[model samples]
Target chain A: MIIEIVSWAAVGLILVTSTVMLIIHDWRINLGALALQYVAAFWLVTRHLPFVMGSTKLITGWMVVAALGMTRLSLSSEEDDTEPSSLLRGGWFRIILMCIVALVTAGVTTRIEAIIPGLGLPVIAGGILLIGAGVVHLGVTSEILRVIIGLLTLLTGFEILYAAVESSTLVAGLLSVISLGLGLAGSYLLLAGTSPPELENEL
Target chain B: MSAPILWIAIPFISGFIILSFLRERISPLIAGSVALILALTALIIPIDTALLLGSVSIKISPSIQFFGRSFTLTTADGTILALIYGLSAIWFFGTEASGTANRFVSLGLMIVALLTASIAVEPFLFAALLLEMAAMLVIPLLVPPYQKPGRGVVRFLIYQTLAMPFILFSGWMLAGVEASPGDINTTIQAGTMLGLGFAFLLGVFPLYNWIPMLTEESPPYVVGFLLWAFPTFTVIFGLGFLDRYTWLRTSPQLSGAIQIAGLFMVASGGIFAALQKHVGRMMGYAAIAETGLLMLAMGLQSSEMLNVTFLLIIPRGLELCVWALALSIIKPKVTSLKFNDVQGIARSYPFAVTAIILAHLSMTGFPLLAGFPPRLALWQEIAGQSLSISFWIFLGMLGLILAATRTLAVFVMANENKIWQRNESWTQLIMLGLGVIGLFTLGLFPQILQQFLVNLPALFNHLGQ
Candidate 1:
């Protein structure tokens, strides 16, 4: 009973964290969410999982590496560093605006899910649609910097789907790995600008 | 005491030690010798399974039957090890190529170690992680100065890393067939997983960028290794996964989905390669095209595709040598990869010019050289699949032939002037000769690698089934 409660609490924390992480658009905050999510996941995976332990460790190790990749996030956030990027100059507004729109849509769906019988599908669809929008924003843009933002948004959708269909050490394990990979990528996308200042730190 | 175990351990230990001590001068050279020894070990080791260090005995062939499933290594594993080591042999030789080769040798050894480890281990997910890390190492190597700062490397790393979770997720999904053993999927979960596994391997849709960035910035030889070796392992590993999950292989729809994804790669890779000029970048497109071919072969869902895989390796191997030899001479440096740079230089280096043409022609699949036969065979296979698709295959082939022609034109128009040449060296001629020799040898005896190719899938089927 005690173990069951711990696992449930862990799952709840992860869901809330995932939702909160998606709503916010800052790299630093997302990094924190990523770190917390992995730690919680490691806790989650260690709870007497029935399958192979080697498999569990290997998958989780990938997650930790990704979460640890937040170090790059810190390095890239510094100014006049490398790759003078056009996207980094002040392009946060449009993305922030999009997030706001996604949030409003998400709010309406949550309320609908309370009353309607089949509203769950629409809720999931809304979430996936918002992610597709994020992909489009990043895909068409020439500035690689924004793609990281796009990756973060897409991952948020994947995590939600990942969480929805299954809630166990395995899914948690996978989400953590995917999240870390996305984090590191988001870190690099920030590095894509070719401004002269960015080149020095790269080598 | 197994050769599989030892072949796995030595280079792995050497690779890590070499990387940790990368700043040391002799480390890489020593690492290369260690890798060479390991490759040799893979050759000599007879296939067998036993616990050396607290190993678990996984019985299937002769029946450890628990819900009617079997998994065991047949004697055929020896050939796979041989193939792994064969590629590693040349890569180990690459250790002697430059200062970078030392570290490259370490990474290459690690790659070998991972491949060796994956094959030995039971759960396919472990192999997937091993492959992912191997892909990740390509990042530091792919860093080119002119391309957008560290972003490309980071993006490559990020995208590859991102693939991990889904693979792990799928690993968990498929873990049932192996662990407790049951019908496994909760309906379409099997199909969804099969899709994710394919996505991870093919790097489908928006998730594919590392290939282009790495090819563009990487040293030609290194690009050559990745172009051929990594995909080969990935396909093998992916097949191992699909083979384990009965739903994927048994269902034609699942197989068709994979084929569609691969076909997309072939079409896009062809279009992309034709539009590019840099030799390394061009190699990337060709590789993408090859990935699609691998998929198409897999899509054929026949052991014959595996035969094509065997034949595939020879031309690709020759092509790598050809590309590496050609690129080392062409432009000679990043400052001048443009066609104009090599122009009039043929007047300065006649032997180099001829070798470049031969190399390019072979790489582009011209007749009577290395690339011709496999391409012809590939056409036959695609035609066998569907004559309508042959148009797409031919169009793709045309794109490759056209790319080759463009590259050759770049050389010819550079104004061949052997009489005005300054000088030539014996070693350059020798390496060039070896590449020429390899191309011709494979071309003349399209059956040179036939024996080995025929043996491989049978082996994989034996182990996997």
Candidate 2:
């Protein structure tokens, strides 16, 4: 019973952190918090699997891909550093985010339990965390490219919640395809906006 | 099933050929001709047998499933295909590219094909995919050279992508309920799914601004096609989901919700259009209003509603074609798409001005034109529900007419009255003649459309119940 409670609480913690991070538009801290949230979610899902090697592989594969994706994202941020971070002064936004997250997390937790039998508390708690992390990145970020990457993470979290009900294979597969499409489109939009050398005079 | 696939496939294959091999000289002509042929075929498709393909077989009807999802493709999809075929044809003819129009054509065909796929494919997942593809494909068209895609396209795409998870999760959730241990909770979950999916796909409240912004950036003809046809297809898909999946119509709340949405659309669209300075944007608003009207009609579900909606199609097509021609002629003259740009164009070309007036009036569902009968039927249907709704429709109609009057005023203002030097060629004469004939023919014989309109309702009854 306590194990279930803790699992649920972990989800609650992640969600609260994420919502707080997002509304405040605090990407740096939110990034750390979001990564940790996913880690906790990964632990929750895998801690008691029928433990199929394939499910294990799928979960691990997603984690590795996600890690690599974030790494590349961070590396790419080298250029963005040239522009000051938009959220450096947004402390009040963070506090307000915390209040909203706490209220929503509490509401969603009970609702999930009521909606889906046996798995409500965990599913609700986890869905909040995943969605919360993504929303932060989306709401706060000004860099168009970064926001796209943030969207992918947010969707990934939702996939986890959806996975609680259905198998991860179907949910994850469709999501990956959608993310790649989004990322490609975002990259195209971003590159299109880059200042060309010919425009040196124009600027 | 194959026939529905063909509705999407033929244009797709033609688009591929044009984009790849025929890029040099005649691709645009060839592409336009093919669209014309497809449109004609769709028009000629015998309403007696709604589905063009011989058998109206159903492979998936939301009852059966594989891998945690449902499927629903069948004969009832004919009207949607017809809608797509007509819209694409108009767009194809309406475009003229000096260098390469094939990419845009390819994208258009792909979008149409995906829309048909979304209609015919069951499980709603296919619909979401098509929606994604449709949104992504617009990137090429929306992000042109001069306007480097300001926040509008970004906002539009993000809103579109955001709708995806709601739809997918809803499908997943509904399936979960279906698989539950003999529970009544399934119904509520399914309802939530429908509400969320419909809201997401239709761009229901906050997310709908994309339509106008899209108009702000896109080629007018192409945007017009998207404005007119794509939402109609999505609405049809949404309506089909309601018809095939559950007892959505019987639920007064569900139908009432749709009516409420329709009311919001009609009301907001009118007020929003009034604020716009661009003619293209105005069309966007008008399309939104038309969408609301279609939704209102759908909500009524008279055994006659389907026919009424189908009847609504012909007038819409005619309105779009006339608008497309008028705009296509005007595109080169104006530097910007603002009303101030073409404020008095009506005085310059009397015939073009007349066509514009009639088309705008018809679009507003004005009297004595092709657009009136359906609006009349729609108002009559709404009146049976409640007088307040009837009053709303009446006011909406008046607002639409006033909007048309504004357009007329703008066109007249744009009219220079200084004889412009464009040649009056045989083809121009033919097009003008076609436009005039299309507008007045139905006005003279309303029965011509009423016959087609009568058979369209009752195409799909609630199958699952």
Candidate 3:
């Protein structure tokens, strides 16, 4: 009974963190939220997988976040030091807009249980929120880095739900590989605008 | 020896090797030769048949197991693999001409291998993961050095990633549907999920806006390779779904949905292409229209669906290569790809202009070109189903033809006072000429392809029974 309560609590935290991640413009805080979101997802996935195995998702997700963070650090300029007011340049209006999106996502998840039943409430709700937030992120921004985050968030949601449906070692490993690859590719794309030091030296 | 090992792993390993040690002056030549040799080996090496060469016997197995998954490349796949690698060789060889040879050849080869593995993997739900991986690999290739990633590339990644969960979820639901075949609600839910999944995968209708944007931002050749490789394999993957599900194959509503979706893509792509100011964006619409044509063929749900689809496939690769190569040649001379930017280019680049026009005409299904015969067959099939659909499809083709004519006018606008010149290298001229001849030869005698396509439908033994 306590485990159930704890799991649901973790899920609730995940939902809040993912929503915040989607709502915020600060890269560091967003990455922090993303890492917490993955850790919370790890709690839910542990129901399906062994602790060590389920923990793989958290480890790999953090690794990805770290890779993204390093990329941001290397690529950040002086102007980026200022805290942006809102996620979108439009400010509070976009925040309210995303809040409405959150409400709609909650509504959609509540209804989705009718079609795809038998999953735990926390898993379903959390997964849907992650997916919904990810979509909103993608739809909201065209920035390559943010778009990559959105994709990663979306995949994390899918992975969490997929663990409940099927558990294959190969798939788990493949998904991990995909997450890592996304990180590297995202970093590459994020930095593609700048010439490498070697290239500059050669020139 | 295993066929999957030869077709999948060898190319992938070779790709890595080239990227590691051989990405030099001769990389394109090496990559092209390797792909060509692999294509030939795939063509000649029969699955499960022993070849006796001077008292030595060798046989390639049909299937291989790796890391608990099975990859089977049956004899039927020989031709498909041959076609894939052969077409891929065309792209790799042209890499030098396009001047993105280093990474394009390596990444292109790896992408092909992964896509092929996606098709071959048993318990095919795994293909979604492989496809997502391939899509990720495309990013570095598409985003050039010292340039920011464009909206098209980001959207492409998001949309492609978006497809995975739907497909994976559908696979889960489909298993339930299979277990309880009598459950109507379950069947409907599964079908909806599957439809949505494939819609995202195939970039159906409104979801396809990124296609043109990517074409506009990236080198036309790379975009062309992506257009050819991704959709062709994805269609094959969709066919696998249809083959496995009797209810899915036999459902009239599903077939109707496909036709409606297909018509929407064709009609919209055509109308938009007709109004497009940029030639690169026009190719994007053309791709969407071709996808619609494939969906139309599949909607026929007839035994000949595979045959018609394969026919479309072969020529599409050739035509896209020609068009992209032309665009890449013309690209260096333009500041932008808008029709206005390309005015009077024919005076400087006549061969490229000719290739671009010929390729566009072929794509528009002009007579005596490679895209015509299959398109004719497709029109007949759709007409048999609904004359309205046939009319809309024809309108779409007509729009493309108009766009092609407009582009041709722009290309030829500069040459009234000056004599025309062929600025293309010998390699470009030879390849373009060969592509043009291949297009006409295939159009005039499509029978040469019939034998290869005849047995493809049999791959789905459970479908159309």
Candidate 4:
């Protein structure tokens, strides 16, 4: 009973962290929150998937963060002149908006449990929240890096739910590969957007 | 060796090899020749039956087991493979002329291989994974070395990725529906999910906003190839679903839903094409319209549905290649493909101008062009069923016609002082000329392709049989 309660706490943390990551625009904070989100996801999924397989998800989530970070470092100019990463331009207004969306999504997902019955309620609710949040993130932002983050968040949510339902090794591996590929592609696009236009051909 | 391994592995391996070694020089010719050879081999090699050419017997088995799944290639697959590889050869060969030979051929070959794998993979839900991988692979091609990815590319990726979960989940639901045929709720859920999944994959109507964006941002030829390849295979994949489920096939409500969806795409695509300022965007709209036609063909309950669908595929492929090649050749001379930028370019590159006009006319179903026959058949089928739907579809065709006419007027409106000149190289002239001729030949003698088209339905055991 105690273990189950802790697991539910982890699930709740996943929703909180994912919402926070979406609400916060700072790359560092976003990355940190992503890592935490994965840990919580790993915790939830560990009940269903074997430990090794579950660890693959967490390891891959970090690897993606690492890939994106390295790309940002390599591509960011030394003479950069922008405010350091923080809450985006609209600030708390956006946060409030996100909170409303989260609340609405939570309500909708809670109701959805009636239709798709066999799946556990917490897993479905958390997964749907992540999916809904990721989509909302994509809808709001046009930045390549942010969109990638949104896509990854959405995919992570899907993996959490999908892992509960189907435990095929091949699928788990393939999904991990897809995650890695998306990160690498995201990094490439980020750098491409940053590169000098005249020197584009050389790249 | 099994046919699946032979077809799938060889092209993929060759693609990687070309990317690594031969891309800098002679890439187009090598890639083109390899595709042509592969297509020819697929054409000649009888799948599932031994062939006798001077006492030697040769038979290729259809299925190969890999990673505990099946990849099967049947005799019915031969004609389809031939069509895919043959059209690919056209794209590959034209890459040199279009000046996008470097990465286009290498990645193009790989994309083709992966799409073919999607068709062959058994327990076919795995196709969703392969398709996701293919969508990822397409990113580098869409966004070149230092070029930022466009809205189209990102949206395209998002939409394609979005399709995976819908399809995978539907497959799971479909298994339940198949197990319990009497369950109406499961059936409705499966059908809705399946429709949405395919709508995303095929870029139906509202979900197709990226097609025009992609055409504007990416190289016309590469975008054209994607427009052709992704939808053709997706349509087939959808048919496979219909083939598998009798409940789905017999559902009148489901069929009506498909028809309405198809009509919406046609009407929207055609009307949008008419209003587009950019030629590349026009091609995108044309693609959406053609996809709509294919959807309409699929929605038809007539016995000739598969034949009509396959018929549209060939001509549509040819039209896109012709249009894209012409655009690529014309692009270097202009900053953009807008009417003002390219007004009266016919004076400079008459052959390309002619090819573009012909291709667009064909797409609009002008007489004695490749897009005529299947369109006529589709119209007949729809007209018999519902005159109102047919009339709206006709309005869509009228929109395409208007766009083509406007394009021609713009092309021909050059200054009288500028001398008429053949700016295209002999190679481009030859390719454009041949494409034009092929369109006419196929249009005039469509019977030449009837044998292949008629036999395509045989691949699906009980589908529309």
Candidate 5:
């Protein structure tokens, strides 16, 4: 019963953190939410995967957040200052969107649970919530950093669900590699995107 | 050594080595040489068969184990590996003349290697992960140093990454479908997921807006390489799906669905291409149209589907090579590649202009050009099936022709007093000339590719059987 309560709490935490990520404009708070989001994802993943294997997702997710944080730190004050104000410039609309996403997640969780029989209700709800929030995040933003974050979120949701399906060590390792690679690519784009353009013809 | 080690690992490792150790000027030469050698070796040496080299017998095994998984490159894969690497060699070699040798050659090699691995990897579902890795590698290549990533490049990454989950989930469902072939619900669900996955990967119809946007944002040469490489591999990967699933291939609705999708891309791409103000975006749309033709070839009911597909594939590489090389040469000379900026460009770079026009015409299926014969074959087959399908395809072709005509008029729009001069460097001229000659040769005598096409279908064990 305790484990069940913890799983339900983890699902609730995921819903809150993912919504925070969508509504918050502050990078630090956003990254913090993402970190907590991973913790919740790790707990849910452990329900299906072993703790040792599931921890990779946590570690990778934290590392991704760290890498992006460092990239953000390295940016010049002027470059960093270009970001929009905290609490998102049209925050109410995002909140409404999040509510809609929540409803959809609730509606789809039961169907997904029926389709993939072995998954528990909490796992299905958490995964679908993350996916719904991620897609909404992607649909609304065109920022490079946010898009990367959104992709990571969507993939995390997939990993959570897929853990219940296939558990090959190599597949797990490759997926981790891809996560790290996306983080590095995001870093590269962040750094490159901020730098001044070179004058030479890029033929 | 095994074929996977030879084709996948070596080139991949060499890419890093070249990036780190070699001088920028010599990197293309070394990389191009290595790719050419690999292609030639694949062509000359048979995998999984013993070769008597003057009484010293040697065999190149087809599969190699890695991390409890296997990557198998059998004899059936030789023609494709050769074609991919050989075409890659051409792209790499031309980088020097196009002035993108430094940034393109290394990552280009690595991208090709990863793509090859995607094809060779068994359990096949893993190919999605490998393709995603390949797509990630593309970001660095597309974005120049110190420049902001454009919406196009970001969208490209997002779309490519998005394909993974759908494909992986579909593969899981497909395994279930295989266990109980009578389950219609699972089959339909799996099929829908698979179609959505590929539509994103191939940039079919609605999802392909990034192509033109990317062309507008990046160099013509880099985008050209992507246009040629990504779709070609994705098509082959899609073919693998058809070959592996009996139910999928035999589904009565499959051919018509694929045909309709192909026609939509062709018609949309062609119509859009005709309306584009920028030549780069025009090329993007044309590529979309070409990819449509590839899909159309796969939709053919005849056993000759594979042959017609290869016929279209081989010429596309050469056509893009010529067109891109010409554009690269002309880009620095003009203010931009927009029609207004390139007005009367032929007066300054006659050779480059001519090459561009010829490549454009070839892609429009002009007679005596490389894209003509395969297009003719496609028209014949489609006409036999449905007159409306043939008519739509023809309309697409006419749109492309109108695009070419507009491009020509723009190029030659000059005061009669303006002098015609060739400004291209000898290397650029020579490469462009060779590419043009290749296009003509393939067109006038399509039989040249028959040998390669004959055995290409063997890669798909069940398709067209």
Candidate 6:
């Protein structure tokens, strides 16, 4: 009973972190929320996947966060200037979007459950919430960092749902590789976007 | 030796070696040679059969096991392997002439290997992940290092990545459908997911905004290679799905849906192509229209679909290679590829200009060009199905023809007093010259491809049968 409660709590944590990710523009806070989101996702995934396989998601997610953070640290202040002037700038609109996402997710949870039966309500709800929040995040921002974050979030949500459907070790490994590849690609794009034109031909 | 190891593993490893160690100037030649050899081997050596070479006996096995998954490359896969790597060789060989040799060859080889693996992998659902990996590899190639990535490349990544979950989810749902074939609800859901997944991957209609944007931002040669590679493999992968599932192929509504989707893409792509002032963007639209033709081919009766599709695909690669190479040769001389920027370019680079116009017309299905015969065959087939479908396709072709005419006019719009000069390098001329000759040869004798096209359908088991 306590395990069920804890899993439900993890689902709740996913909801908060993903919503925070959608609204927050600061890279550090967004990355933190993404890390926490993955932790919660890992917790839920363990209910379906083995502990080791589920942990790959958490490890890959944190490594992605680390890679992006390192890349962020290496950037000049001008290059790192995606931070909003005010915390509330468009934050409220995003909050409103999150609210709509939450309501729609609530409405669709049962139908998704009906389609992929044996996926518990909490898993379905959590997965749908992340997907909704990710889409909203992607729709709202075109910033490189933000787009990468949104894609990672969307894939995480998918991983959570897919973990229940497939348990192949090879699939798990391939998915982890994909997550890492996205991180590396994101880092490359971030650096390349900020570099001077003279340096373009060097690579 | 195993087929997968020979085709997939060797090229993959060679790509890495070339990237890590080889000089940029020599990489294209070596990579092209390797690809050509692989293509020839696939064409000549039958899998699962022993061959006596001089005194030694050799056998290439059909399948290999890795991490509990199977990758089987049978004799039926030879045509596909030959087609993919042969076309890849052409692209790689022209990279030097196109001036993308430094960035294209190694990565191009790796991308081809991954795509080949996508075709060979079992449980075929794994093909989605392989394709995603290939898409990721394309980013570095398309965007030069330390350059600001354009919205086109980013959106390309997002859209391609977005396709994975849809396809995988549909694959899982399909497992259920396979067991309970009568379950309409699950079938509908799975089919919808599959359709949406492919619509995104194939860049059908609305999802294709990134294609033209990509053309504007990246080098035309790299974009051209991508345009050729991605859709060709995806169409094959999608054909695998239809071949495996009885209901998906048999459903008339599904076929109609595919035809409608093709019609929308063709009509929209053609209209956009005609309206575009930018030559590069116009090429992108023309590609989208050609892909729509592939989809229309897929909607035909199973007996004729494979033949028409192969005929269409063979010419597409040749046409894109010529067009892209011509554009690359001209790009350095012009301010931009927009109509205004490139007006009167033919006065300087006559050969390149002529090649571009001819390639564009071929794609527009001009008579006595490579793209004409398959298009003629397609028109007759679609007309037999529904005259309205044929009419819309014809209208699309007309739009393309108009675009080609406009492009020709821009090329020739020089001052009357200007002297015609051969500004293109000898290498560029030779390459373009050969490509032009190829277009005419294929167009004049479409029967040249008959031998390979006869066996190409064998790639799909149930569909071929």
Query: Which candidate leads the pack in DockQ?
Result: 6
> What stretches of model 6 exceed 4 Å from their correct place?
none
Mind giving the per-residue lDDT tens digits that candidate 3 earns over B4-111?
Answer: 888889889988998888845688788888889988887787777999999999999989987677888888788888889999998888877765648888888999
**CAPRI tier for the interface of model 4:** medium
lDDT of 2 at A123: 55
TM, every model: 0.73, 0.78, 0.95, 0.95, 0.97, 0.98
lDDT of 2 by residue, B1-465 (tens): 245434666677777777677753455567667766765655555322434355662331222333354333343444444555755665565454211245666667767776666665555555775677677767756665334556667776777677777777767665665566356577676667667766666766545787777766666666666666667777666666666545555668877888888888877776677667777777777777777787787777566666566667667766766665666566556777687787767655556557666877776777788888888888877888789977766666566667777777887764345555443345544565676677777666778755444434444666222
The best candidate by lDDT is 6
**In model 1, how large is the Cα lDDT of residue A61?**
40
lDDT of 2 by residue, A59-177 (tens): 54345345534534544454545445545566567556656655686777777777666655665566665666566666765565556656655665665566566554434455555
Can you write out model 5's per-residue Cα lDDT over A141-168, one digit (the tens) per residue?
Answer: 8877788889988989898888889887
Across B1-465, the per-residue lDDT of candidate 5 in tens digits comes to 999999999999999999888888899899999999999999999999999999799899999988788999999899999999999999999998887747689888999999999999888888999989989998888888667788999999999989999999999999999999999999889998998899999998899999999988888898999999988988888889888988877775887788889999999888998998898888999999999999999888888888888889988988998888889888877788999999999889888888888998898899999999999999988898899999888888888889999998998999999988878899998898888889889889999888788789789988866
Candidate 1 colliding pairs: A82-A197, A82-A198, A83-A198, A83-A199, A84-A195
- Indicate the residue-level lDDT of B330 in model 6: 87
Which tens-of-lDDT digit does each residue in B214-325 have in candidate 1? 6556566666676677667777777676566665567688767777777777777777777776656666677777677777767665656667655666567556655665
Stretches > 4 Å off in candidate 1: A1-33, A39-203, B20-36, B49-74, B95-101, B144-152, B171-189, B204-209, B301-303, B329-334, B344-359, B415-429, B462-465
Please give the RMSD to the true structure for each candidate, in Å. Answer: 7.4, 6.0, 2.3, 2.3, 1.8, 1.4
**Candidate 4: segments with Cα more than 4 A from true spot:** A77-89, A93-118, A196-203, B51-58
Q: Score candidate 1 by TM-score against the native.
A: 0.73
> Candidate 1 overall Cα lDDT vs. reference?
0.57
Query: How much is the lDDT of residue B402 in candidate 3?
Result: 91
lDDT (10s digit) by residue, model 4, range A1-203: 87678777876887677767766666777778888888887877776789999999899989999998888767656423233454566557657766776687678766666766656666776677778778877887777777888888888878877887778777788788888888988887777656665675553
lDDT of 4 by residue, B189-220 (tens): 88888888888899987999999999999889
Ten contiguous residues with the weakest lDDT in model 2 chain B: B57-66
TM-score of chain A of each: 0.41, 0.64, 0.85, 0.84, 0.92, 0.93
**Model 5 score (lDDT):** 0.88
The local lDDT score (0 to 100) that residue B400 gets in candidate 5 is 89
